[model samples]
Target chain A: MERVPILKIGDILLVSIQVDMSDQTAVQLQEDLAERIVATGCHGVIIDITALDIVDSFVGRMLSTIASISKVLDAETVVVGMRPAVAITLVELGLSLNGIRTALNVERGMELIAAHTDEREFAFDDEPDTETTASS
Target chain B: MERVPILKIGDILLVSIQVDMSDQTAVQLQEDLAERIVATGCHGVIIDITALDIVDSFVGRMLSTIASISKVLDAETVVVGMRPAVAITLVELGLSLNGIRTALNVERGMELIAAHTDEREFAFDDEPDTETTASS
Candidate 1:
């Protein structure tokens, strides 16, 4: 597994990792990541791991732990870019990530956040527009 | 599409979503996620979307964004539970998440992190054991 690389865009953080789906390196990366999340005050996070062959129980648990820690620090996390074979194996293995947020790719993950921000703006605009109409 | 659910285990938070590949909900979800990431200081993230039938460019883009944000927050993120069909479609569409961390399932993601923590402990133990042997 390669070392995880982190980049930032605006308030969002991007983490790129090359993980061997069947190795211990993946676990180490998670711990390192958790520490970073705490250190950085940025709220958004994106994880890109397109290179993986399999997934096991240990990896899943670590991810959950990371998410929990992030919440304590007031940051949000998202996972993106996964291979299909690995996905199937995970389900067949009965590995349930019941509460994790996931997207097909990183692009989609970003979109999710963008939309939310846009919606808030729209809602705010709507209130002002309605007020103008009422005043007129 | 059903709303994505945020799961909490101990101090860990998992964000899980079920996507409909044919619809635009996935994209919307991505945008929404970005906002949440910014608002919540949770770096550890898990995305489980195994129900998608197809993955397109928009979805791919969102995933990329999610990964990017994670990096900014210095958090760890993992994509889990993708279907084979969706995976093929993403690749066929030339959608690539060149730098992201991904897993087959939630469990495996946890394992990856656990293994790393374990390795660190082992290394520390080894140092002490080595000293003991030298003295003997």
Candidate 2:
């Protein structure tokens, strides 16, 4: 089975799905990504889908699954470079892609993840209960 | 102190900020929103900023804080009706508003939150381990 390549750039893991994703390929990618995130301790994951000409419900579910997995591992996932047709098709298919963050391109995805990481770190450095701060 | 009025429409809570958000007002709004969320058990919050002409760093932070509070209470926050100028200014001021969802208008915001709420409920109805389902 063909496997998706995962690249590490800075503190972010970059995965560009250039090949048609078979079910087995998607499963392998998830396992590989989980391990990569733990080994590298990366705080960001950017999935570039620009090369994908078609995205069916299965692919949409895979993206959402990847995002949820990364979230559980304390990493943010951003799906970038979705073609317009793919987006339309996902909408038509009623796959809302809930809980997944998206960006127009890879650069913006990096920026989004970086900004979020900084904000989360800053929040941590402050009082543990942010609600108290707001109340005060 | 001027208070922001929160209206309940169906299963969603809507708050339209027409006046300037003073520190005290912001604090009060947060308290009110938290209480309302608990009392009403609403799963979605739509904050309409259509009337506001300016959004400074403080306002930006207030929005993020509100979103966090809502999330903790098991509700989703969607800020809608952000004027173009306000968006540009927010970008210039470097307030990324991380974790807070946005929509072009209140109608779209409602749809976004509705879709997400349904997805969550559906996920709950299925196997709790969604990751397992995806892998299979």
Candidate 3:
């Protein structure tokens, strides 16, 4: 089983999926990410997939699953650097990746996470009922 | 030369692309949407593309152009109802439709626009530099 490394930068977790993903590798990543999020108590997660040329359904679901798991641990997930071809292919595979946030590159993703972390904390504290979410 | 209707939902502009888009139509939309955005003083735009089965580069660029136009006027655009197949085909066609916000359905998309409009106004007042953008 291949392991995906989860690096912590400041209070954020950075994950760049650089290899061709297998079902086993993806599953291992899901488990590993959950453990990492719990241990690190990170505020956000940014997964860069710039190196991946092809993304099948399994890999797409893995991305969605990772985002879901990260949310459970009180972290926001932003998948970045998705090639145009890969995105088109993923949608064709019947995975629109709804409910997941994405950015063009790592830099943009970092900005996104940084901009939200504070607002999220404020929303959670000040107005739980009128919490504003940027989900589409 | 068919005209796409831009209906006003309060201060939000709702546009549903219900016909197959030709180059001219797409171009016309870019112009018409901008004018409407400025005229109505709307804070957000929701574009429903569920009726579009195939999105070529021209249409893809049109969507991107519309998003850009909205932003210039201080308005946010959320595209919704991207079918599974259309998403796959567009990416294969080499059009990623980056920098545009997307939603699973029209209802969810409207919610996105409404939520952001309120938050955006406050952010502009509080911290102009930290505008929370949800782009892919």
Candidate 4:
């Protein structure tokens, strides 16, 4: 249980973590992840937490901070696999991660990344071909 | 254009890839990640997609599959960083990732892991020594 698994595929990384409602370990984990993210040069981060049944303001705030910090590092972040119950809990608890980005599941998250990548590439490709010469 | 920049944290590999939505790319990434997770023996997988603006049934299915694959490889996956707009879009689209795990952000994702770790540690630590048995 002391192990946190994170997998990197291309530019994206996958992470899975467990949680309990009545403890401070969640806070510690947040700080540890923030530090790890800053240390690693991954372009994107995904957090999957389907195990959590309830979330409070403190948990919500930590998540917001992590997202903010990830952005500061120039990496995009997404949340996936949210249960309706947890979503309702968060809303009822008056905890909202307004600016944080999230997806329903991992596939959507990947699509987001693909969209961004495609956009960037399209933008670059659309630039006039400086090396190509056309016969007038 | 194929890179999924989920979150960029200065350097560390926070949760990178979660679910793959790009037809072939998604499958490839999922396979690659499964292999890596099995080889490296990591415990948590975070899939963040703050960039996705849409979620379709295909993507939802893919996400669930990835979660299952990750679990088989002995790694837990947590989808993190969901956006409200996207969530609403998914609901409107009638897409659901019913059996997947998720977190709101990296902080919660990490907290989830930490809490699990603490639970195990406490469970073991709280065990009374046979020589010094105490009544609760």
RMSD of each: 21.2, 21.1, 16.3, 19.9
- Please give the lDDT score at residue B68 for candidate 3: 90
State candidate 1's DockQ: 0.02
Q: What is the lDDT, from 0 to 100, of the residue A36 in candidate 4?
A: 62
Which of candidates 1 and 4 is the stronger one according to TM-score? 4
Considering only N, C-alpha and C atoms within 3 Å, which residue pairs clash in candidate 2? Answer: none
- Which candidate would rank higher by DockQ, 1 or 3? 1
Against the true structure, what is model 3's DockQ?
0.01
| Candidates arranged by TM-score, highest first | 2, 3, 4, 1
Model 3 fnat? 0.00
User: Model 1 over residues B1-136: C-alpha lDDT tens digits?
Assistant: 3444344322223555433333466555555556666666555566655544555776666666766676566445677767788788778878886545677866676665455445545756778555323321
DockQ in order: 0.02, 0.01, 0.01, 0.03
- Candidate 4: tens digits of C-alpha lDDT, residues A48-136: 66545556676677667767777777566777767799898888877887656778766678777666556555655776452122100
Candidate that beats the other on lDDT, 2 or 3, i.e. the better one = 2
lDDT tens per residue, model 2, B1-136: 5656565656787776756788999999999999999999999998877667889888899999999999889899999878899999988988899889999876688788888877776777886677334322
List candidate 3 segments past 4 Å from native.
A132-136, B1-136
Deviation (Å) of A106 in candidate 4 = 1.5
TM-scores for the candidates: 0.40, 0.48, 0.48, 0.42
